[model samples]
Target: MTLETSVGNTQSFGLSSKYVEKWEKRSSIRTRPEKKIDFELDGFFFPEDKQPVLLDGRLKDISIENKSELLIRSLFKYLNDIVTLEIKLINSACNKIIYNDLPVAYPEQIKMNAYTVIIDEYYHVYVARDLINQLKARYPYLTEDALPDSDSFCAVNEIMKRLDAEHHDLFEIIAVCIFETTLVKELVEFFKSESVHPSIKNYVNDHMNDESRHYIYFLELLQYTWDRLPDKARRDIGSNIADFVKMYLNIESEKEFNLNYLDSIIADHEENKQTVNAIYKGFEVTPDVPIVKNVISALKRTGLLDDENVKSGFTNIGWII
Candidate 1:
């Protein structure tokens, strides 16, 4: 089917035709030759002795002990605080920017619907925090304030800022399309895993449904933006996407062992340092296999990781194991 026809059908499913058309156009744009980016994995895994401490379920399953319960409670409080901060940040950063750029003749209904989607995402995160608290009450050891913090969010913000500052027009489009869409989908899936708390699973699943729609919105936006760019600008965006993929992959590598993440835990003073250290050490030991393999697998399954352009780019960067 033609791009326009496919988009029209998608609009029948509740998405805006304008948005779908944009995505369709961007998908048609020619991608640049992929370049390989060098990535190192030498000290990636933690020590084996650190395993038990890092995987300690006592804090996450607090019902077994008073100490664990207290830790769980503290964690919930911290998470609530962090979620509130995130809601505010997203609102402030996204509101004016989205509305101002929207077409002058954009229907109020579409605008309202778009705003609702953003608001729902904020609430979804909030609900996830609440579910974490519920799980903590039942399984204190399973509950830990292990969620990312304002600073963690800031890291993403910094990347966005840099993209905007350096690349301008294409940053929002590509950031939303290639990066945010995929990351949110992966996060939702990660949370829904059987290993996670039931409450957390349910909460994440609910959010995932909304995120799927948002992902489509981003894809549409990307197509629209690409279609409007000059040939040179389109090439620049392709280059930017190549650079961003490398940067994003490196950031993902650190997710397995970021010490700053440990700061959010609300464990006892004595246990905190030990637990954090153990967790850090646990992550230090490299699995017999390469971590990037799992990452690449996920990317491939998502239909975004194995694109010929991206593969070529990584090859050029010497990312092959």
Candidate 2:
């Protein structure tokens, strides 16, 4: 199903028996391409504009081969992040709902759909890995151990560390809700980039198809949980949304990581090292505007942003004006 048709306004829909049936039928695992996707000789592994250091235009002397390495490595890091998010964060929270381990009971339909989400998420991991393996076959230099660390998973762990043990699962659900919602937007950018390889684009298309459904499911989950959460729990989770956004979107740290990695790639050349340092000195990390917008919209739609504390926390952090 197209995103426009699949996702209506979050407040307007409920997870009914009919919705579950449709979701399962259209899910990527059951319906997406089964054959291995192969890349074209000329297309990029990742978009050049999406890479901040490359986009900066100051590193004109960088070789085409090195730039390709950066792009391919960026793709590997992106795929690795999907593996981290789906298996580590989303599925873990889905397990909680499926097993009825949360502080409150979700609707029967919502619980049933968690099973579908787990299936879809695992399929996403499979698809991402398939692409990673394909890339590795061509670029023997790209190894799993060399991929960049996942900022999202690390951020989630830090958030969980601050919460009481009882609220850990609850916060996981909240974090995944924001993640799945924002992810739909992020994937669209990937799918639309013409410079990226067709196979990569196709993989993103398949993943986005599943993510669109997951987005609605998590929105429903958010509304259900927010209404039933005790006041103290609500305050605890709501108050931390801003902090979570900062860590999860750690724009500066991510830029630093990318620049440092690029420096490592060109360490032998003194002039290139100086250029990398200059680029890092000049580059600034800004919040992903579209993602930040979607996150706040999800919170508002679910009424979490209605709480004075929640709204105030976001406002103080400049996410809300």
Per-residue C-alpha lDDT of model 2 across residues 40-124, encoded as one tens digit per residue: 5567778887877774454567878788788888888888888988999999998987785667776566777788888889988
What CA RMSD would candidate 2 show? 4.4
Residue 261 accuracy (lDDT) in model 2: 67
Provide the lDDT at 143 for model 2.
79
- Model 1: per-residue Cα lDDT over 62-157, one tens digit each: 343343333334335334534654364434434533565532223443444356555655665556465554555556455344544333344345
Best model per TM-score: 2
Q: After superposition, how far is residue 150 of candidate 1 from its true place, in Å?
A: 7.5
Judged by whole-model lDDT over C-alpha atoms, candidate 1 comes out at 0.43
**Relative to the unseen true structure, what is the C-alpha lDDT of residue 285 in candidate 2, on a scale of 0 to 100?**
20
The pairs that clash in candidate 2 are: none
Backbone clash total, candidate 2:
0
- TM-scores for the candidates: 0.50, 0.87
lDDT of each: 0.43, 0.73
lDDT winner: 2
